[model samples]
Target chain A: MSGRHRLRALGALVVLNGLIPIRTQPFYVVYLLASPLSFLFFISVLSSGAFVPFGVTGGLILTMLSAGTGLQSDMTHYRQDLKFQDIVVASPVEAPTYVTGMALSELVYSTPGLGVFAVIFVVTGLANLQSIAVLVGVLLLVWAFASALAFTLATYLRDVRETFMFSPLISLGLSVLPPVYYPIDRLPHWAQTAALFSPTTYAAQLVQGSVGLYSLSFGHALLDWGALIAITAALFLVAAFKARWKEP
Target chain B: MASAVVAQDLFKVYPGSHSRTPALDGLSLTVPTGGVYGLIGRNGAGKTTFVRIAATQLALTSGSLSVLGHDVAREERKIRERIACVPQESRPLYFLTVEEVVYYYLKMRGLPSVEARRRTREGLEELSLGEYRRRLVSQLSGGLRRRAMCAMVLASDAEMLFLDEPTTGLDPIARREVWAAIRRASREQRTILLTTHYLDEAEALSQRLVLIERGRRILEGTPGELRGRVRYPYRVALQEGVAPEELEPYGRVATVEGGQTLVFAREREARELARWALERNLRVSMGPVSLEDIFLDVVGRSIDEDTPAEDAEPGHDEAKA
Candidate 1:
């Protein structure tokens, strides 16, 4: 397909899966924001405002990561229940275009929650011009990596029910266990080393470093950005090119 | 006069844990452009597999299949742009209204908004779905949801249309509406490949039909030509209490469900048997041989008996090929 036609398909799919569903009901935004805000509230209460920045930044990262991991259920439902993916495969839209469109729809669905986190981050003086730029870049990478991984996993599922429990477990591993809501240094040396295996650890470090929530050397900050980009690019390559688009 | 789809020595082996099952075994046929071509087969006889392979949604294990004169494996992008499919397993997005479902589907297929809207409106009216255009698909009946799916594809400008059991869930009146819409699409010089279990539907809509059994082509001809190939020219269905031996002298006798006996014979013998049955105050009906009779003769079983449960239920067949 030509670039223009692919763009049209992408735009239409985003509207179909994202905007129309929410617009029709208009109450789903509350559901979208509930998880992240609740986490923020509990974390703030436990720390007595001492770790407000961590809570705010973690809420932002969690919201973005969920957008990608949440795709596991959405895509499995589309492929297994609705069979809409079959309809999409038969169209002029290629596999990468379809995956990207679906990923963007998740981002759109999580926008309201992300906006809430952004407001908190700015009001607490944790976000400046340079920090906001870095945060946006990091969140996009997190979203991209999470979406690609989730989409690849979803394709292997024979049943949609598998995703209901599977996706949240993945979210806990990728986001919760990787220092996304806590400082990496708080873990023992060996535990911190293992956390580096997850892309979210790097994402959290970069955002915290830019916002002055974590003490970091300039060299360390650059390394975090490079690692996050490489991990996201590698996964995106697999999702766009090697992921299964046809049944075996 | 030109072929829209041509498959040569098509074969598909579905990988299983212990033993590989073959779905299509050396199945071959040529579907002519600008007409309704019916693929008639029992459930799991490779009808869905062929449509999926032709539509580029599934790859064949080993075969040479082409759509619109392009290789299916290599030129799938070119083929996809020209063909639209309403897969039997597909359902409309329930969150969207019937109108949005059709309109957005056209847009996703690269139509401009104005053109997509125009075609969506036309398609809805053609299928008698205009009344439910604004209602969510989740609120519609099963038949209406099926109609919504048909409208999504029928509104497109694709040259080759693959409709797999497009009328399976519709009522008689709704089925006729969809058939009319299909006829209109065919009249626009588009090629339609339809797979169906309904014998009457195949006879009514298809210009030519291909009957397959156990993943092989058993017969291929127009409806009349296939009927002509049947050795028996007439069929007499007798009510219960008739012995199989009683009709054996006339022609082939088979006891069907409810103990009803079906006899296939020449018109003279068939008429004689009918008359004898009627004289004895028995219920008997005689008619010209139908496509079903030919199918039973060639495949050695009735289509309804061979249709698997998965084909009737929506969620049973998880595997696509």
Candidate 2:
């Protein structure tokens, strides 16, 4: 498929996958909504009301991160179980097109949770219209970055269990280990270095910075924005092109 | 006119396979357009690997392949636009209704919206999947799902089709239904490359057939030509219980079922064998051996004694059983 037609397919798949969770497995919706809220509540109760914004950040990060890196399970089943990849591979649709559509589908699946969180943000007086727009932009970066990494992982790990077995650990590592709940200043030097590479850290920084929860300089925020976009673009290229579409 | 698909010296060695043997070893063939071409092989015979490569679902280790005059390596996109496949292991998306599955696939193939809808309706009706058009595919039975796959392919505007073992798991009725669907698919004289282990299926649908073992074409011909490949032109099958050794005195014998022995021979020899069986108070039936007999003969052993196994086992179904 051409770039334009692929975009069309992506749009259609996003809309189609929106209802997949409802018709096929409604439990996933409850799980996605509930699991993130439980963690957000824990963060809030542990700290003072000062950490409530951190709680919201924690919830948003987990919701998007789980859907993103959890691609290991979704894409693998689509390839090996349902054989959707084999179907699309033979069609005019390009591999990149298929990958992008899948990424969007995951994002689409997470939308309801994102919507619930958005309501929480508005009710708590945590986000204004501008912060919401920035939150959307930053989450897109995280979605692309994590999904691309997961998509690239899928090309080699043919087995679903082997690839997805790391999901809980990945989601935990991306959501908790990063400074999504605590401030980066509190992390030790080595972990601070590690958080630099985690896509979730930049996402939290963007969302936290958007709500004026963290004091930031213009230069650093500008750098974070560039890092978010550039790193996501690079990773997406790696996932879309580095995949071994054909056996050598 | 040029052939629909052509390959020269194709080789596919799967990475890290237990055995060192390549899946496809120097396989080559030409499938002309305008009719169904059957490829028959034993399991692991490279029938699927060959079709997969031709269909652009795989990369060949070494070879030249072209479909509809487009080189497989460089023109895969162009080739993909012209072909559709019902892959052996592929399943329809359970999330979509049967009609939606067909319609979406056709749209993905770049069919115009109206054309996609019209053909989706036509395909569902043609395959009798119309009854379940609005139902999710996951709710359909296996037989109906297979028809849904075929309907999606038939709904497309593709001029070439790759059908790999389309009827492997269907019941007799379902198999016949699938066969009818395939017949309709080939009605417009579209080029169809079919891989099937069922001799009856091949003979019933293919205008021409090729038998490959170990990824190389060995015996190929029209069904009649393949049937005649055996030196014997007729078979004398005992109608009642008789020792196969008893028929050995008349001609070479093979067992078809419990108490039924087939004696392969020329017309006169079969007549003589029938008479000998009758004299022994055993009833016998005589008729032309079928393509199944020819396929079994070729797969089990070389057609000519001088020809070495030349290749590893294709893992023909009976051999595996």
Candidate 3:
């Protein structure tokens, strides 16, 4: 009925995120912080000094992973386990606001990934004002695109098991199969062509370009920017227009 | 008074293991504008499905349905603005305190923070959750969690409420507490549509009632009217020493605890039964049958004495989607 309700939903979403750290402390450590950071560390030791910031990419990508996991866990928990979807669906809140509020909440919950990136860059002497600015933009863009896609997919999946079973496959595939962990330029032409479709490839390129880690052609940068905006806008539109608020 | 909700030949066909079955099979019901209306049935009788459709949380497979004169299919937002639902089996899921759960839901329902807090505290006090207002929902026991969930709806000023088995898992005393809270929440402007497995619950709260079976409305009336409609409106109970066959001349007979109970369909039969009981040197009394008896009579037996589970059969999620 009012903008305040949207604000309340957002507030509740933040509170919901805050509670997660306290409730699942072990999960926060083992899966959220440790597992991803450990992988980033593993990748850091093997790569060249110039690529130590590649660890930041791992941290950055995995931090946004909660948006996808939230799609799987929180959406399923709200719909299946707690049966609270009806409560929201029956309210005056629009589906887009609910989806955006929840995605932003997961982003808030996974903010420590920012700290992970900060620590890696500071210790590795790779921190620069311009690179940090690019990293922030990439995080927000990737989260918006990925969360939109995740929200759209959740509209079709039936249960917690299905959401869970498919979500990690999506997040891991998005993170690992793209240039998030490796350089796109060194890969085969076929792999580079495929990576063009992934936003992370461009995101990695954008960050690396900002820090002079990779050579990005001006024309190529224009295409990357277009792909990021176009894909995100399209996904957001589909999620907003087609997400099922009630059973049809 | 205007009808608060109207459903005519409503159908909700859920995908099943092999074939499709209507959860709300040709069911039609009307709930008036004020006081409490009860929908009571056994498991899989489509009470929650009916409530879901009315609340605009699920679409009907066919036929017409509306809430507060707003079409369920086309005017969901208008109906949602006026109605609230306490969904069945919704535990206290959020990590908020008991009071915050109520307060925030009120906020989500469009109330200002101050009023939300005030109504939340009022709901908390009414439901006896005030003592535990500061406690997290997960910290509460099962009954208290249910109380918190009910308070989430009670804290709102919605014109109507769809409460699906609000007292399903409560202890007797806790149940009475919930009933009292529900009574306090009702006003002339408010309509309460609730489902229950407890006959006493229906008898206590409902001004009008509908008894559904497997998604069909088998019986509908005020509790007293329903009781009067019972096939065996008069009941005879004799000591355990008496046999059921001895009362066959009167009416239907069945074994009840500590007695052989006889049911009579008419006053003449009841009079004859009482006279026979007296003449045979038997200790017996004839009384008007209760709503529970009518429920048993309608359904051929009572099966709700067991715990109330909201149709948890496999592959039943399609309707709630």
Candidate 4:
């Protein structure tokens, strides 16, 4: 395929994903928000509610998990085929640069889903002017952290079957143990403390705080965002180092 | 001429579940700066492992390898900058088009957009892939995808090129086209190291050939030099009246028909034997020698001969390091 065609295919996928929320009604919205498929679905459904902090938290968690699954699949397939390593070694491209391109592509691919949720919130009278900037910041943070973690985990995966088996297990454990669907105060003190250690919990908290769905101190939200970014950066470095460009 | 590629006592060992099996064992060879070099080997003879290490896509367990005077271990980036490789059974990114695949490599090599475009166009034209430039790689046929891959490597403008089984699944015509392009590339001063199981291909293109069996170099010479080592004279046809036993006194003979016989004679006696047969009122014909015959003599096997099918996998050798 030509370069232009590949880019077009990616653009088409983005547009198709973006239109899903705009054309659907409550049934589709409900299915999206409650399903474990992708966080974007939950975010789209929750955008219709005036005070749905849990929905926003659920959506953020879902987005991270979905992105993780996507990264894991890509990494696993590449390892099994060995084509990725062959291309990297044969071409002049460096491993880190190739990974950076993949990350950026993920960000671009995720834009439409995030944009659709933004539009839904605006049109449904769910998001006020005060929360729009915060919503955008949370989306960016979720994407960066999710993509970085996926890239890092990919370094360890040797095949697609392992990735398929492992990613959902990790996502499922994180979903049940963290503040994705319920507020931290409602959980046991120890569970809440443990949730604090999960990156998805911080992301969920930040999304809820931004949309006015949950009551949180701005300082606490800022700290969560900072921690997420730092973790993403550190994971990125480790992934770059651990990637085996040459076969051993 | 300076050597384009050099290796000394190269070795590679894959850690097996129970114990390590050496993939390459004290293997060493050199290629002159120009012309094609063919690496011929059986399935488990370590050809792929050798190419992988030479391409700097795999690390050796021991020994030194250099390409264009750059050591593969320490000067990998420099060596990579000057070399291009077409790996066996490699495919392009599923989402990328043929043009994109070629352009991406050029861009990575620090070529400007204009130069990248120029090279992509030239490579596509050379490989007859210009029409498929806009199609997704996932949509192309096997042959076209292979062509696109070759174009991608060609666009890199590397000085040395290594192609591992470049025509493995290609049709006869497609294989010829690929060979033509390879010849053109060589004319432009690109040093090519090709590995193929096809004896005819090796004879047609390679100036020097190396035959490896079980991770060890068994023979290294020009096709003529290798062919010269086989002293058996090719047998020709004879009239139906000649009995097979009559030719037995001349050499080892096998009857093909009532009158015809195949005789394997020493190089010195072949001409005199043919003359003697003709004097006996037998119509005689002579056969020409080929690389296939020489390969059989040296390896004690034929490509067409069936061994246990399970022996197709590469065999393990002792690790040099």
| Prediction RMSDs, each to the true structure | 2.5, 4.1, 2.9, 6.4
lDDT of 1: 0.85
Worst 10 residues of 2 chain A by lDDT: A12-21
Candidate with maximal lDDT? 1
Best by DockQ: 1
lDDT of 3 by residue, A150-174 (tens): 8777766677788768866876667
RMSD of 3: 2.9
TM-score of the first chain of model 1? 0.95
Runs with alpha carbons beyond 4 Å of true place in candidate 4: A1-51, A78-82, A120-145, A152-162, A173-177, A193-197, A210-230, B17-21, B94-97, B131-139, B229-266, B272-288, B304-321
Q: Which residue ranges in model 2 land beyond 4 Å of their true spot? A: A2-4, A28-30, B241-246, B249-251, B279-281, B301-321
Query: Which pairs of residues collide in model 2?
Result: A1-A92
What ranges in model 1 sit over 4 Å off? B17-20, B239-241, B256-260, B271-284, B307-321
How far is B67's C-alpha from truth in model 1 (Å)?
0.9
Top TM-score hit = 1
lDDT of 4 at A184: 72
Q: Give the per-residue lDDT of model 2 (tens digit) for B215-251.
A: 7887787888887787776878887877666667666
Model 1: per-residue lDDT, tens digit, B1-321? 769999999987664412234577799999998989999988767788888889998777898999999999889889988988898868998899999999988888888888999999999999999999999988999899999999889999899999999999889999999899898998999999999999999999999999987678888999988978888878999886687877899999854668788899988999899989989999999998889888888778889875453322112234531
For all candidates in order, the CA lDDT equals 0.85, 0.76, 0.75, 0.67
Which tens-of-lDDT digit does each residue in A19-104 have in candidate 4?
32234332432332334434434544666543354654465456545655565666556644536556557655555555545555
Candidate 3 - chain A - TM: 0.89
Interface RMSD of each: 1.8, 4.9, 2.5, 9.1
Error of 4 at B75 (Å): 2.0
Model 2: per-residue lDDT, tens digit, A90-129?
7777776767777777776687888888888888898888
Candidate 3 Cα outliers beyond 4 Å, as residue runs: A19-31, A48-50, A122-133, A155-159, B15-20, B241-243, B254-259, B305-321
Q: At residue B193, what lDDT does model 2 achieve?
A: 91
